[model samples]
Target: MRYLPLTETDRSAMLDAIGAPDVDALFSDVPPGLYLDGPIEGLPHHATEMAVEKHMRRLSKRNLAAADAPFFLGAGAYKHHVPATVDHIIQRGEFLTAYTPYQPEIAQGTLQMLFEFQTQVARLYGCAVANASMYDGSTACWEAVAMASRVTRRKRVVLSGALHPHYAEVVRTMAKFTEDEIAGASPSLTATPDDDGLIARIDENTASVVVQYPDILGRIPDLRKIAEAAHAKGAKLIVVNTEPVALGALEAPGNLGADIVVGEGQGIGVGLQFGGPYLGLFAITDPKLVRQMPGRLCGETVDADGKRGFVLTLSTREQHIRREKATSNICTNSGLCALAFSVHMTLLGEAGLRALAAENHRLACIASDRLAKLPGVEVLNTHFFNEFTLMLPTDTRQLVRDLADKGILGGVSLGKLFPQEDALSGGLLVTVTETTTEEDIETLASALEEALS
Candidate 1:
């Protein structure tokens, strides 16, 4: 029952083949004092199943779940009410067991779903094409930069100040081994985003200008202007969208001339399962860049019988292509999450999506109006879909902790996002969706007043 695949003789043979005396010899470099000899300090050797279950239940009770609090947190991952229908569909036997479509003949259902998902994403993003899906938004942002570097053959990337700090860091981290040069700055604590300043940073050497729509600070930047400037300098415009719901109300970045659009698709259908297995959306408005895009692209086609079907028309992942020629090294796509998003989008048709967006903005405006009346609080953005930055009179990081102590999942603090930037210290990023109620907003407002006073 204890499924140990290898016998001691088998292990010894392998270790001997590798010229090791024993397993302990394998870890010769590890400090003897640091090595554990036996049972860890004081843990019980064993426990009854019921006892363990009870212990776990007690531990879980300490966690302040999003539903149990006045949740306002959203930088990348969001808290939205995913319909029961989304779950029921994704849990089907066919979808639950679906994996990479190595053979299209047997995976018609999976392929067709992916094809439909891609179509929905393409239309949602206003792009000519969208990949099946990627890891998550931050990594997708990095992929966009790498793709831009490939298309333009330039090494310099200019990042907007308002771009998500996590996304920017991911780009910088990935750029270490590559020749790409990243030019980035911390966001300014103002209602207006520095579009002009960002444009000035773009030059002939720039391969891409990356900007986030409904940015980390919750202020929307003018993507069209940024796109035009990037084009003038022969640089691709990479737009990152963290909140896909905002797109229902705001113009798609692709419509504003973004060359490559990458973002987190966690806002729809996907519940924030404590950070991940979220979906990443990557698309291209310019069809010319399709060959250079990452991940798989499912396209409609026919088999030997000539009946309409679907297949992976293009997969540039390293698995399906020569390592040197592959567009991306991603092992697999986020298939299940993509299915959930597609199903949710299908349920919320065009009208439902718009109505959802309207309610979000309506509630957000109400929260903003109520909070702005506080003695030292100021809502920074003059316009926003559902999320915005609030400049607090006190240190925001401490205030957030204080709010959390009161069982309220307060907004993200700029200090936590960009710790080194003193100018951004007091900023708080608050998000509001239909799930956030008028009472929740009041609870937060009352809590903020009491704390500030």
Candidate 2:
């Protein structure tokens, strides 16, 4: 049974009504050469459900799961232990079936959870307030840059060379339509800063300076100095944290004078479900800038009888209200994922989170120390959290492939993302979470030795 809702006559009539002589007229705006010459090769006009399911399953089988092999991969998305209870609680009918709360009065529980989630994020980042959540770490970082520019009323955005490549691309894409000036610091996988200096580029016209915490190379920057430099030029400092677990032991980005702190909350409660549906934590300093922040914010309020209740506040800047003038067009909230984060953090508490963070750092340090002893392999980061970059004597891409064949999930290859660039073409960035065990570290170390040898 074909499921075509419209008949040939109906299509013709609709096209005629729209004053288009043919269906091809609808796509007149698309250039001739750009038009597809034929249909896609693999896709069929029709297929059985079982065939489609089998095809999808076969394609999925090609992918290597994190648990399938000794895994060690993290630039932004991480492999962390998500307790079964977190999944159980989020899957409840009431919470799982809920959507964005348009009516604050009827959505007390949802609003309260969001409010508590905001509080947790603010405390973790040392900021005044946080939104519910954004799309992901990259999108959140992009929004932070845009918000900083709007707040400072400036045109220039300075991107650190050490910033994640994907994150830098997102910012560049957003800046294109606004015609804002974006200067990128030189690209390098090495932890140490070389000739291309971004700190020297800041001036009065600079709206914001963006740097990543435990950046692409897994080296922690002296953000206090960078923040001071940006402030001296009247620019807001937007700090990005792809891995938020590092915050448990490291100085909060807000305390280092960061105007905005943005990061992926996957390490907290979200699962690395093949890099999807992760929570983005966005926080800012003063209450004045709260209006410019993206996403919904939940606040405590009083009912008509003076009883306390929670409600969605300052939603006028969302897509539902301002339309084109909205601070963010985002509508769907990572509500369940955010709830999972809150629940996990509540269970961990401050001390437990700190201990978990320390354990991650310890594992990573041991792994780096062991791997650095191998010939032709060098540890490039002096200061880091749970992740770091390694310089390989051979091409990192080939080394990674070899390691994968050996049943070891190797770190991300720099050359894989930046193929044209020379600096990062030979390096690989590795991460060790609290979930990573000593045996995992040994396997990675031994696998790298065999792959290189």
Candidate 3:
């Protein structure tokens, strides 16, 4: 039997209080076509826990598990080895079920963990402070742009060609309703824009300029000059990083004079579960701009007893208190994923992370060198952390499909991501993480060569 605690009389009384004649009246503004005609088909009306578990288990067998394959597909998401300890700590009863740490008295542990995670993120990105976390890297990118607009009081934003396409799209979507402007350059394998370029597009009206570190194509550029140019025009420089692991070896964006640093935290400890359930790492300089920071921030303090304690501090801009006037409407961040990131990084420490990053770069270079030697393949990036694009002689879409038939997961084709851009149809962006081995690269290279031939 199913149960709904809200009695029919209780619901009707509440609806009458709101002056809504019926539940359908509450949805009166919804477009006719947008509403479903009826209930979804084939869903079970009722089931026992055991029966549901058995049904789900059968359905799960049809899905492809990442562990079951020698996976290499990383356009933005990646596969890395998560230590056993990460999952162990994350599954602890307190950490696993703990939601928002709103109450400091009872939620001290959860708040403290988030505070530590924020500190680690700020240090990693070389920013002054970090919020708890956001939905994922893409949303954080959008939030950063919005924050920049507020700080500069300017409406226009300049985006580098090196920025990820998905991040760019998300920003544009978010900015559509706002009184802001966004101009971005064409996507490319290299950070160097065409002579008629990204710098030329910046102006006094520009609120911020965004670029990616070890960008979408894995080309790492010295953004210091670009940041300087934007600063001259009174525009803030926001840098997005998809792979936070690269920060262990590469110069931190804060060192490069970036005003804001945002990225995906999945590379640290979280698995690439389809897309996500990943954590968004957002940080910034200047405490003056801290009020505009999205998401909750956990701060350290002392209680009445005077022992060290942590609480959700500086939350004046959230939806609860400020409503539409809030800096961001974001609530309920990725708490579990943030815990996974913190636990994983705690176990790795600075030394382990750097070593892991070094291995990733080394493996990627090996893959690039071998793959470049293959017929009709041209390596595009000169300095890359762990990923690069290969300009193939044959159509990449056709080649990748052939490789997939052989049970080998191939990299993403540029054409698929940017369908309107025919010029990039032959370029394929491939990524290699610490988990990839020589055997895996060789298999990919062999399969790619066979497919191309």
Candidate 4:
């Protein structure tokens, strides 16, 4: 009755063809102690549709839905108001069902969308060129590091203490297999983007220096100094941004002398659908680095008819060419998500995006001021876009849980991300978006006051 089509005979034949004795042989490398002895204790082997649905509903009730509460949760992923038009446009068959635009002639629509997306990304990041897209922000961070290494012919990467920990981990994981040296600093929970130590760590072997704009703790640091130091040491400066909307108000990283700018595009036109299907934004100021860039690049050109058309110009992935010669192993881009971003951006235009960004900053300022007035709570950042860290008197992990119990989706607990750091034990990372209303902010403030009391 289960949907699995394979029978014992069919599975046996396939295994024999592959020269494996049994199905378990496929997992032979797994240690005996790690294997489950039997089926899980409580889960049912079978259940009716109605029964399963009822059980799932009960489990779903245990989760505090962000939209249904006074939500303030944002570490990297943020909750924003996505227009209904974005969903409607993306769901159209031409956009929704489309995959990679492998052929130039027939896939003009898809290619054009990617072309527009790339152009928008380049403009937003203040970079000269941008690819179609990558997996997400974190993977894009790794690709930037890889690209920098290829460009500089150096194996060492310097990571700032203010960079998002998850992004840093991705770079470290990729570097570990490649045998690259990574000098990563401890997470900083301060107002200053103090990179003196990070700059000192850079050496002749350094390939790139990765730092987050309006860093993890939400401090907006001047990147020109860092960029100059990295260039002086013959290293590239790769700036990371988790919130793309922040770029609307802040100066572009490229203008600040960043060689490469990469970030998550989920804040624009994309909903935080329980943490994605998110979009990755990658851009570079120098055109010479295009060959080393990962993912696809869409170019506008004239066809045989002399009409302007879009095409996949640069596909450096293994699928399109020789595996050994490929610039990146990433096979495809987030086409539908990228399209949604494009549509939303087109709707907002330049003026609308700036207004949205300004509103976000204003709301955050109001929230931070109110929260800082609470007893035993201190706002950590001197300058920020819309998100900032707070130092609470008590442990933030339990405090977040206590807030959640009161129908509030409180901000992320810093200690949960970096448990080894005693300084961050009482830290909380809160975010305020345009979607965060006055009522929501007040509810959060009142809830925090009660929780701390």
Q: How many residue pairs in model 1 have overlapping backbones?
A: 0
TM-score attained by model 4: 0.87
Residue pairs with backbone atoms closer than 3 Å in model 4 (clashes) = none
Model 3 TM-score is 0.89
TM-score for all models, in order of appearance: 0.89, 0.87, 0.89, 0.87
- For residues 214-234, write the lDDT of model 2, one tens digit per residue: 788888888888888888999
Weakest ten-residue segment in model 2 by summed lDDT: 187-196
Q: Candidate 4, residues 1-453: lDDT per residue as tens digits?
A: 366799988998999899998777788788988877678899878877888899999999887777899988877888888899999999899877876788878899999888889999999999999999888999999999998998999999999987888888888898989888899989766677787877888898999999999898898877898899999999999999999889889999999999999999988888887777888889999988787888888999999999999988755444467577887778778888898889989988999899999999999999999999999899999899999999998889999888888888889998887777888989999999998988998999888898888
lDDT of each: 0.90, 0.86, 0.86, 0.88
lDDT (tens digit, per residue) of candidate 3 on 324-394: 89899899899888989998898888998899899999999999999999998889888888888999877
Candidate 1 residue pairs in clash (backbone atoms < 3 Å): none
Predicted structure with the largest lDDT when compared to the true one: 1
What's model 2's lDDT at 320? Answer: 83
Candidate 2 versus truth, CA RMSD in Å, comes to 6.2
> Lowest-scoring 10 consecutive residues by lDDT in candidate 1?
313-322
